[model samples]
Target: MLNFLKKNAALIWAKKHVQKAEEFKKNAEKNQDELLLSLVDTAKKTLFGRTYDFENIQSVKDFQGKVPVADYEDLKPYVEKVKRGQRDILWIETPEYFAKTSGTTSGSKYIPISKEGMPFQVKGAQSALFHYIAKKNNADFVGGKMIFLQGSPELEEVFGVKTGRLSGIVAHHIPNYLQKNRLPSWETNMIEDWETKVDKIVEETERENMTLISGIPPWLIMYFEKLIEKNGKKIKQIFPNLQLIVTGGVNYEPYRDKMEELLGGKVDIVQTFPASEGFFAFQDDYTKEGLLLLTNHGIFYEFIPLEQYGKPDAQRLTLKDVELNKDYALILTTNSGLWAYSIGDVVRFIDKNPHRILVSGRTKHFTSAFGEHVIAFEVEEAIKSTVEKFPAQITEFHLAPEVNPEEGLPYHEWFIEFEKEPENLDLFKNELDDQLRKRNTYYDDLISGNILQKLHITRLQKNAFQEYAKAQGKLGGQNKIPRLANDRKIADLLKVYKK
Candidate 1:
């Protein structure tokens, strides 16, 4: 009776919001312009506003001229002031929370979430769920137990405001309606050790009616493997009602095959493009290949061409100017007071009518050792295409440049962990090389010019990535293996895991 009531209420909400979303999609361009002006108008009295002359910034070009494109380093001075309890340094008021982020390579950087801006993060998530419900014409998943595999919600006071991982901080804001259905128990989730937390999560959820499970792919893989091992049953058998999987932070294609294998069948996947900076985009249309870019959200975006990034003559374009399939460095001026901030992410538009995009790669996280800059999208797509022909079950993989080899020319090295490797490894490698070459012309030229050898693959033992993550103290919770690096830092560390 309770579940039935929940589903009906959710469906009603979905219908209303779905219509609003369509309206937003139709006026995306106008909405972006209005949002930009509104953000500037709101901050016109703040410290940054006075410095950038936000009052005189009447147009996009005016604003762009007033404020240069900024990265974290550029804003660090302002961020430091905010940390010292200085008000209106960036935003008008004090931040509601400081989302502490720790990447695999970088140290903790605190990203401010203002009271006005914070709701958009929560709303983006709620809107995604509502859209899914409306599209499917069902909210059955809400009726069953749902679990979000995330960080500990316990937060510390940073100066005066709340501080923790983005996921951890978001946990505090879970809607009252979801509190009843959400699982793993507050106690289990608070466990700091990821392995222990996963074990506890399995114990708490394996026997429940889990219909929707949400997490990054790598962590979910860990949870699924443990559950299967414990019961000697597929995930579907354990959670018969399980129907939906929500994923973000990383690409979903590489893990799709492995996840389906673990589940013993297919489940609906709703890929989201979210981060501490902002909840940017989410999968609204199941039929589409890319996520629907949120136009009405408190973010005004600047798409800088990937080639022209960081250059003085680089073009900065608004939504109307972006072309489909071309890579762009995603920059944001948002409600959080980020002004032309390059969040280091790269995206490509797949559709223009509603502006659906695919997260292509990161600006700083690609291989450019020999001027052959191989991106995450290219490598993942190449592997995806190669695996279609070769039949390989990839657990995880990473690529790094091999600058100094024992003998012969330098080459790109692939460290792959496989559940089921191809029958003919040599043929599989050749096909993979060909796929990569087709996608990346610089690599092909290097190979043709004999400047680099064919890419080499070092087969890694099972649980290699897991072991590597555990070694780094980042086994779970949003930390993903870097796709490619210019340096061999990760490659050298992964050498021991090679079979």
Candidate 2:
């Protein structure tokens, strides 16, 4: 009865977020304007502010002129000073925690999270849940057990502040209301080894009333696979109350087919865009295809067109300047003290009124070995479109360029693990290649001009991706395999598991 009341009260408060969101979304420009001024007012006393002359900054143009668009490398010097217990270097307040994450070129990076900023992360997640509740007008799942497959909650001190993965850090901030409904005991959550952790999770949740699950799609796949392997039945059969799957960090569309297969049908999925730096957006409307930008959050946004990305005088555009369907690199200036920070993710605006966007790909994660810049969005779409015609069940896939093959010309190597292979593998390959060619004209030219052969498909054994991730000490949690790379580092590792 207490649980029932908690659900009712939580739903009532969550609806308030929907109402608040409606207010700002109507005037995203005004929200961003006020948000920027608030951020600037708080950060104007820092060392960075003095250097950039933040006090003199009056308009968006003035702010952009004062602060250059920066990458992690550009901001590393300031970050280093903060690690040595320096305050007011970036923001007046010291960071309470540093979220550690793997970097693309750099080995690892530590992102600061301030006391003032941390609550917004929690609220953003809550707001996402609330938005879903508002959309569906259903909170039936809240009374049942919920699980969020994440990294260990254990943290280490970095200087004076705690340091851990983004997910782990967020774990400590889960609201009191959710503490009762959430599952997988704290001791079970503390297991460092993912295999052992999943085993314990399977045991703990096997017979429980699991109504909702949250995690990256890949890790959830592992958990679902383990449960099905043990229980000898599908997920829905085991937990009939399951209603919603909250997923984020990576795109969920790529794994939709297999995830549905495991669940024995379709289920509601709410996609969110949360990172160590900030919670940027969440899927607000079920009918829409993209995430709604969080303008009222403490972070201010800037969009740099991918085409104009690397130029010396690249234009840093505001929300007012962005157009629909054009690729742009996302930048953030947060209360945590990152100034014009490049988060490395590419996005495309699908709606402008309320500012809804699709995460296209990463800035550095692209296949351009032969000057054909094939992005994650294009490749994933190509595969998704081809799968419609081929009717194959793909478990996982990765793409890398075989720049120097033994005999033939260069080509893209697609390592695919299929649960159910298409009846005609040759036809599937032909159709996929055709689809990609239609999408990326440069790739089409490369193939047509004989600069490269048709992409090669190396059929991988079941559990191939899982095995590869296991070998790298990144089997579960927020870790994700890059969809495409310019080199063979991942491709060579995956070769051993080819069917």
Residue 48 Cα positional deviation in candidate 1, in Å, after optimal superposition: 1.1
CA lDDT of every candidate: 0.90, 0.89
Instruction: Give the per-residue lDDT of model 2 (tens digit) for 1-499.
Output: 9767867876787788789778888999877877787788788888888888889888888898889989888888888899999988888867988999988676799899888888988888888889988888878888899997667889999788899988888889998878887888889999988999989999999999999999999888989999999989999999998999999988888898889999995578999999999999999975568999998778899999998887778998999899999999999999898989999999999998889999999998899999999999999999999998877989889999999899899999999999999999999999999999999999999999999999999999999999999999888888889999989999999999989
lDDT measured at residue 124 in model 2 versus the true structure, 0 to 100 = 88
TM-score of each: 0.98, 0.97
Please write out the lDDT profile of model 1 over residues 1-499, one tens digit for every residue.
9889989999999999999778989999988998999999999998999999999989999988889999887887888899888899899987888888874344578888888878888898888888889989989999899987668899999679888998888888899989998998999989999888999999998889999999999889999999999999999999888988988999999888899999997678899999998999999976568999998889999999999999987899999999999999999998888889999999999998888999999998899899988899999999999888977899999999988999999999999999999999999999999999999999999999999999999999999989998998878888887888889999999999989
Give the Å error, residue 193, model 2.
0.6
Give me the candidate number with maximum TM-score: 1
Error of 2 at 106 (Å): 3.0
